[model samples]
Target: MRGQFPRVFVLPTKLSPVELDRIEGSVAELTWDAAEAQVFVGKISRRERALFELRRLKVLTTETSQPMRDHRSGIPLVKGAKTSTRRNGTDGPHQYQDTDSAGHDEFQPLRPGHIQVVRLQWLEDSLDAGAVLSTSNYLLYEGIKVENDPQPALAPTQVSQASTDDIAHETSNRPPESSQYSAPSQRLRQGSRERRTSSGGRSIAPQRPVLVHETTSEHDLPLPPIPAFLHTTYSCQRPTPVTTPNAGFVEELKKVRELRLLEGDSIGVRAYSTSIATLAAYPHVLQSSFEVSRLPGCGLKIAELYQHWREHGSLAEAVEGSKNERLAVLKLFYDIWGVGDTTAREFYNKGWRDLDDIVEFNWGHLSRVQQIGVKFYDDFKLKIPRSEVEEIGSVILGHAQAIDGGFQMVIVGGYRRGKAQSGDVDVVLSHPDETKTLRFVEKIVRALEKSEHITHTLTLSVRNSERGQTALPWKGEGRHGSGFDTLDKALVVWKDPEHAKSPHRRVDIIITPWKTAGCAVLGWSGGTTFQRDLRRYCKAEKGLKFDSSGIRSRSDGSWMDVETDPELGPAPDMVTAEKRVFQALDLPYRPPEERCTG
Candidate 1:
């Protein structure tokens, strides 16, 4: 057996005071990656004890480690960290303290007769500590059990009195005892009870759902297992009751989805969105990775990643990728209202790392809209609660009516889709007389711009993208606009008039000719994928064109003037149009709330 000489194993830290202190002082940016803490400390080629003893590899005790210091600066590494005077002529100027595993000393050199198994494990603060402590899921070497102590080894007060401004404020280097790491004995070798993974790998309890394949004999087509109380893959098939049973899983996937989005991976975002929507609609607690892999939106890649989570009780990819330096910087710039994914990447390529970089050195390159985005980065990050969205909608509604009582407004987008908080508020505006609404966008901007609640005008236009016509809602190649950016709209910054520190939120007002009010509302009320599929269904299946304004017949390139024609009109409106669009495509109508697709 080839034994590696003694080397210090630096376990990656998360929410602990040790890590938080580093971040607070800007000394080290703590990595949120789950896998960083799980890498093999040393790869062993053979397990024979006689061969290993011949190599004379040394064991490292974490407790005996001395504090590390910079070579030039000679500054202490971690604050309040105890330093040892004894240094065994190490190469670096400083050395870390030597100690056993925080939870136990099970992590030791494997004997000639034993095979050491390195597995991912989760460590949690004891439940008896008044509050359920956040999970500190990590990989633990030297196989252990899956339980935790009920009492915390270290208290918050121990960390509270430390210097908030120093990275060296760690209270103790000793890790708490964990219940998950079980010392391997004779019983562990006889793997009769646990589900065995392939190739003598670590095994965890499997929670595979009994999949009852629908019509086990009839259909030649391959289909996924039907989950309990569900038959169709489309989200609209079920009520998708509003609940938070799958918040952790959903949130983890969303971070990935958002990461993909920031990196300009449109296809990846769409794929992840499908899974996100499915997980959000699921009712049961996700007990195992197998259950998540079987769901409609998930594929093998996602399934495998989730399996790691099931084994460790922590998301592996989420732990590592979310804090990736490039991705983090990209997300910061990409989230700016004016910046698109393409633009965000461009900024990154130019060495613009963050808002500060843009403001300090490259301010001249920013467009007017980007300047506004930079100015209110923090405000835009704040979500607008459902109540605040309604308040803003009411303000806009009141303004529209005052201009012309005939004009109508309907809040669409995420707010209309039942989200408790939305990144921005979408409100659709229309008037029966298409001529009167021709320039209503300009009028609304003028009116809203005067209000104390309006902080900045991000965008205002008659027809953004200014394309004459489209096959769908901006889907074709060389598309002139941000697929949904072509409609006549006003995008503004809004805040509560009373509170000076109120969050500045994004609000969009779309104006459609009253003749096509229904089509407009249908277009704007999107979960992204739903709208894309809806349009594709129109063009390919029905030979009909669909967009924000109205539907048109592809046969002769003529508007489907259902409402304007007296013979067809019972004074048709948005609701009637929405239903007819579904009918024209021979699809069951899904409500605005159920369009949580893509």
Candidate 2:
């Protein structure tokens, strides 16, 4: 049954996004293009409504006069006024011999290109029966494919600034004129009309910039081949450059993903993450919806979004979310240093619409860290310049070395990934001797605080040192709490005393044993998606558990010697050690710049 089902297309009309995704996933052979579907499944029941849906999809068809017959049984497969049932009350193979004036029994001879519009129940019943059920009881209309009438020429104002080749590529991949799909340009025209009528001739919001013209030819010059690493589902295996041709579109998607996060839609967040990772790795600028549909993790719905974005210069949902008051408030709380989605919703539920509200009404109820977050919310929101980030790292490293001259540090996080500025500073400090690192987090924070460089300690954890600084056993998920990893660390607020006007900044100083410095650096350097996939890749493929603390064999929970080679011995520097760790994991060494799987 895996691939036996007909090519099916589920209409989005009158269905929730969750419902649409569920039905799409249940289909064994779901086709993105309506023109390729042998069956159209939707909630619609009336003949006129079904025909309207077909017209919306640009499916031109001629209604058949005769009832459809099952080729295998040579029996009429049309439902009558009454359905036959077995003794057990299950659907029976009832055949219709006569029809009313409306031709309820009328259906086209189902063939390769002909289509049958059926109620959603057909899918439900087929799954319940564990077989493809006959459509007799569910059929609403049937039609033979027909050639599409000519579309009118585009008006002068309707032309886009896209390259000729891109337009040609879009045209070449378009479904047949009378097929079960409308051209993107045609859809945009219809969408414009709908918006104008619904909103009294004005757009709901200002649109984004038009898609810039692309010069690459889809035919004369081939699309850059997908990198071999991208073939795998793990994003850590792929190279996602910091700058991509699709960065603008990716940012648009990130906004929607962020909205989902604020709305507490975990599934939606994960779905968007996968799509964003895939698109981030794609080298070419998208030219058509078909291009989007073919990419890994991107499906028909995402492709439709790409089409809409290309035509409208913005996603409707993203624009609408930006203007949503609830979402806007949630985003405000979520942006605080120590607040998460759950806490953001909690704040909103308490009627704390802004930082002022929280400060005035719920100041005592907030955690110490969250209270600090609200107090310095404006300062924390300010982007830390690369120069400032480097200065901050230098100051922290200076303090660590003051305690012990052997201390060495590597600034990880976005700064190492080639960002012009970072939201915060993250530096991993280590020493050549194990004794120097044990319980080092407290010493470092105390030193910074004494020097007036540290304003507040958000949270300090010595879990790694308490657990003897070894990789904890892999007890699977839910075994770990908010910290997730057991690296000794300090989350602190820092401000330069040298410059009184400087903004307060968030800084994380992590202390790792010199042996696992590679793991610490690797884990913290990559983007969120890159780090997630790295762990997943390790667990699924290498039978190992990975965290910023260290990597351990899942089979026996023993630490793997990833930083040392039998010939070269231990790596001399943190960066070199990180390269060795990648090699030991059987992963290609991706530079920090190439690990931006956002």
TM-score of every candidate = 0.57, 0.67
Query: What's the lDDT of the predicted structure labeled candidate 2?
Result: 0.72
- Write down the lDDT of every candidate, Cα atoms only: 0.52, 0.72
Residue pairs whose backbone atoms clash in candidate 2: none
Off by over 4 Å in 2: 1-224, 481-483
TM-score of 1: 0.57
Query: What lDDT does candidate 2 reach at residue 112?
Result: 63
Q: Which ten residues in a row have the lowest lDDT in candidate 1?
A: 181-190
Tens digits of per-residue lDDT, candidate 1, 1-598, equal: 1122111122221133333222212211111111111122221111121112111111111211333333223444353345442222211212223222234222234333222211112111111222311111111122211223333433666443323322131223322222111221111111123322222222222122222222324244444454653323344434454445767666777766675566454444555665676676666776555555456545344555565655565664455455566667777888898888778767776666778989998889889888988998998898888998999999998988889998778899888878889999999988776666776888888887787667777778876324433323433434454244355788888877788778888888898776667777888886775665565556545777677766667666566754444567634556676676565556777776666643
Per-residue CA lDDT of model 2 for 1-598, tens digit only, reads 2114566667655555556555644553555456556888876554555665676666678787876554334456554534342222112222332221122222233586688887676677666555676666566678888775334433444344223443464467665532223343333212222122111222122232133333346335455665566556678888898888998889988987786577555545656777898899888888776677667666555676787788798888798877766667778999987899888877776666789898899888889998898889899999988999999998998888889999889999999999998999999999988888889899998889999999998889999899777656666545653226688999999988999998899999899988899999999999988897787778767888888877778787667778977998877889999998999899988999998888
